[model samples]
Target: MKGDPSPKTETHKITGLILAGGQSRRMGQDKAGLIYRSRSLLDRATDLLRHLPVGDIVVLGREDTKYGVRDTEPHLGPARAIRNWLRRQDKPMNLLVIPVDMPELGREQLYELLAHEKGAYFHDLYLPFYVRAAKASAVHASTERMRDLISAFDLTELPVPVHWRTALMNINTPDDLRALEERQLG
Candidate 1:
């Protein structure tokens, strides 16, 4: 009974973890609140994960929130929040992490990462990733940089898709978000 996963959880193969606790210094506002095709970045990330094989979804940080864990450390980058969530898990489970600012990440793209031996990530962009829960401590100790943490593994590195590279871009600043909205219109 102690080791058994709940029926609901048992049916899920992967757990979706939305990392939304960033300070958004560059964006000049909550990046999660930014609009992307009418939906907020936070809503889009959660919705994309829901279309996957994930058994459950949790968000890290953000107040007045729903379906997530608070960052506890606030803007200490992703390591603090991820580590906090990792230590709370009763058992090792596969985790799919997606940053709230990556508005264009889709189910197909995430699936590509999960298809790897361990997991996969864009050659440079690494927030949206697939990692086993067991590596939480290792990842925490590894580095605060998302790319470094993920690259330490023998995971597949994806090449930038020339056509959709903009879609995968991170909206880190107000200008970045504005540029993307302009691209969408033009």
Candidate 2:
């Protein structure tokens, strides 16, 4: 459960992780590189992380020369991808994980997740998680689903406000992207 309503301070030293290594099977193209509001999804995700108090940010599932940490295996799904990445870490720190396809996610939403002292995610959502790296070994689930991973950690679930629901929209297909664009424009 969430211990305090206070915001996490700069001294907390959180590492931001952008999960962008999906195969984009439904989108038919790399969703990470997809353009939205004139910026790539990866860039948008990175920019959102940069605005937070995180100490460092890493982009997983990509091979960029900067900030990118390639997964040992491609298309491992979000849970396994995260697990693999966490296993390579040298020290323990809080991790803020977000997906590249969530183009509508904002810093305000992310701040809400970070407000929890322990591991937490929005109710009914798996991405945009605040996980304690020290507890990585506690996730022993054999399933690769993110929901199972979250449950294994016993992370608190913060209620998402009605207005912020759209912020959780994940653009997995071209139609989804078009719908988001229309909603944004309309």
Candidate 3:
């Protein structure tokens, strides 16, 4: 069910997806379940996204209860997971895809991405994407072979201003999380 669009709406009237199926080799634990400020990393991300201009939020993970999260894995890797999300979505073909490991995302950063780019792409391991869901989904679906799909598609990077770059940082290892936690504490 679609609601009337309003400036007060936190999320766009688009699909909001979180990538959370990583094996977490470096962390040696489920990154999505990590705690920050007393909340699970995924929980914090979900709270942030709730205030965005998005509609539905879907989480793609490897198993239904691996991290005790509401959303489970649809498949492995971002491309495969998103393909599943796109298949399930019945709304407009636009989506805001963020990672589960990014616990520090803020509204200002989200609005900035929405304002400047028709879509957003990440060069790093984990970052949010604002995109035309159909086109992005098509590209993701076409890939079954292990390839550098982002480079293959020639998707352009939506330049995030310097100040907002830190907001996109993702937790790939325990050391990375420790650093981020220190940064947050400091």
TM-score list, all predictions: 0.85, 0.91, 0.74
Give the CA lDDT, 0 to 100, for residue 176 in model 3. Answer: 88
Model 2 ranges with Cα > 4 A deviation: 1-8, 141-143
Predictions ranked by TM-score, top down? 2, 1, 3
Question: For model 3, where is the 10-residue window of minimal lDDT?
Answer: 1-10
Winner of 2 and 3 under lDDT: 2
Highest-scoring model, TM-score: 2
Tens digits of per-residue lDDT for model 3, 78-167: 766665555565554666678888777777766654553345464553356565534544455566422344443344465556776668
Measured with C-alpha atoms, the lDDT of residue 159 in candidate 3 is 58
lDDT (CA) per prediction: 0.74, 0.83, 0.63
Off by over 4 Å in 1: 1-11, 140-142, 151-154
Q: How many backbone clashes does candidate 1 have?
A: 1
Clashing pairs in 2: none
